[model samples]
Target: MKRITVIGSGYVGTAVACLLSTKNMVAVIDTDKEIIHKLSKQISHLDDPQIKKYLKKNKNNLKFSTELTSAISKTDLYILCLPTDFLVSKNEFDTKNLKSVISELTELDPKVPILIKSTVPMHFTDEMNKEFNRDDIVFSPEFLREGQALYDSFYPSRIIFGSKKPSLATKIASIFKEAAKNSPQVLFSSAAESESIKLFSNSYLAMRVAFFNELDSLCLSKSFDAKKIIEGVCSDARIGNEYNNPSFGFGGYCLPKDTKQLISQFKDIPNSLITSVIQSNEKRKKYISNKIIEKKPKNVGIYRLQMKEGSDNFKESSVINIIKKIKNHKIPIIIYEPLLRKQTFLNSKVMTNFTEFAASASIILANRYNEELNPYLEKTFTRDIFQEN
Candidate 1:
């Protein structure tokens, strides 16, 4: 079995480690001691069920460590899955963490082929290769969803490798393909093209989300049947029927940052739709906030802080934006999220008891409808027409 080293133990890293460990000896390294401790006990820090199962079953082949030097020394194939958060002030991605990992690896002189699974700015991989004076680095974009990361990794839609060396690209693809249950289509292209593919792909999905949210906004203003209109429009074969569900906005780890990053890359280029997509999402959130304000509830009860179901991530979540807007209007608010252990969030009281939370607020704002809110459906305000996340 191939000895593979995966850096980072977040969503993408954990999923990749679990998938690869089924057939290869995988070492998962992260700076967080608590995450390392959890993984060492065959416990997954991520919320993905598939990842937890795989980690439990494949503990024999998987290794967890906080020491990067030791892990890199044992494996020739390295995968970097570090975070590259988008910085709004700089209008660029903060890739310092990724760069640090690469720097550490270079110092250790593993000299092995390194594959980047993190989403980065266009031409970043190529520039990094030149900066390090190494051609063995590759960029392979990951398209796994937050809640179903491992499931998506085990059955990828497509595999694209960005590498100048065909032999090394093939070897990287082989490892993923052998681990994946489905024989996905594999494509090799330049690093720049691969980066553009990732940015454009997520931006397109964001655009679709904006389109549906705008449609919902119009229906709300004109008092039209949004569900009927969506049904009729999506019935067209050309339009298809995916990503049409409406929410507060397209706020998640990928969509918001990717859309903004794509817009930032459009410098000197004539583009209207790309820039407007970002604006539309912001407008959608404001509209949702105003609608809640019109109700003039005693206290606004937030059903959940997460962006979607089965996910614990609240970073860049649309509901949080809605909460801020409501707070700005001098309205009292309470949050009900089981995932949060703290009694307070952003200066607002967090209700651990569901019954108390539901009873305190005269009206509730739910981004996505859930069955638990059924008894209080009349008091809930939501734009979830399809009841899907």
Candidate 2:
């Protein structure tokens, strides 16, 4: 079995480390003691139930540690899954975490291949290789949903490796293929092309979301049944029924940032549709905010701060922007998010009791509909026509 060291214990890192551990001697390294401690006890730090189940059954093949130096000894391969959030000012991803880990790993001068599973800008792998005078770095992007990370890893839509060495790429691909339950299509390409693939793929998904949201906006303006229209359009078979459900806009860890980063990459390249996708999401959010404002409610209750069900992340959530717009109109806001421990969020009062939260607001805004909100459907505002994410 190949000795693998996976850096970081976040969602991507945890899922990948677990997947690789199925056939390899894998050590999952993280700086957080709490995360390492939990992993040692076969507990997951993330919200994915599949990961929790996998960890319980696969603990024998995995090693959890906070010390990177100890974990790296005699490692056959290293996979980096560090965060690289997009920076609006620079119009690029802030890859400081990846750079720091790479610098430390290269300083050790280990003769092992390094796989980057983190999302990065175009030519990032080549730039790192040239800077460090190493040719062992490879870029492999991940396409995992927040709460379904492990399940997706077990049955990935595709597996791709971007490297200069064909033999090394093949070896790595074989390892991942062994872990997956299905035979996913595997592609090998240049590092830059792989990076572009990730950005373009996410941007395209965002475009689809925007297209439907704009359609919903038009339907709302004319009192047309968006559900019927969407159903009819998707029946063409080419359109397909997946990802057709509309929401406030496309917002999560990936789509918003990736689409914006893709737009930045097109600064010199001629493109109108790419930029419009970002604008369209913004327009959809404003349209939603105005609809809420038109009701003139005394207090607007936000059902959840999460982007979707079973997810704890609210960063870049569409409702956040909608909240900011609603606040400008001087309307009091009450948020009913159990995830928030604080009494206040975004300068709005947070209510823990669902009944009290529901009773206090004149109207509730839900981006994604839930069964609990069925009792208050008349006062609820949402665009979740399909009731699925």
TM-score for all models, in order of appearance:
0.98, 0.97
Per-residue lDDT of model 1, residues 1-389, tens digit only: 89999999899999999999999999999999999999999987777788889999999999999998777567869999998899988999999889878877877864888999999999989888888889989999999999999999999999999988888999999999999999999989998889989999999999999999999999999999999999999999999887899999998899999888998898999999988999999999999999999888788999999998878899999999999999999999999998899999989999989999999988989998999899999999888999887
lDDT at position 66, candidate 2: 93
**lDDT at position 149, candidate 1:** 93
Error of 2 at 115 (Å): 0.4
Clashing residue pairs for model 1: none
On TM-score, the leading prediction is: 1
RMSD of 2: 1.2
What's the distance in Å from true for residue 371, model 2? 0.6
Count clashing residue pairs per candidate: 0, 0
Q: Give the per-residue lDDT digits (tens) of candidate 2, residues 149-229.
A: 998998999999999988888999999999999999999999999999999999999999999999999999999999999
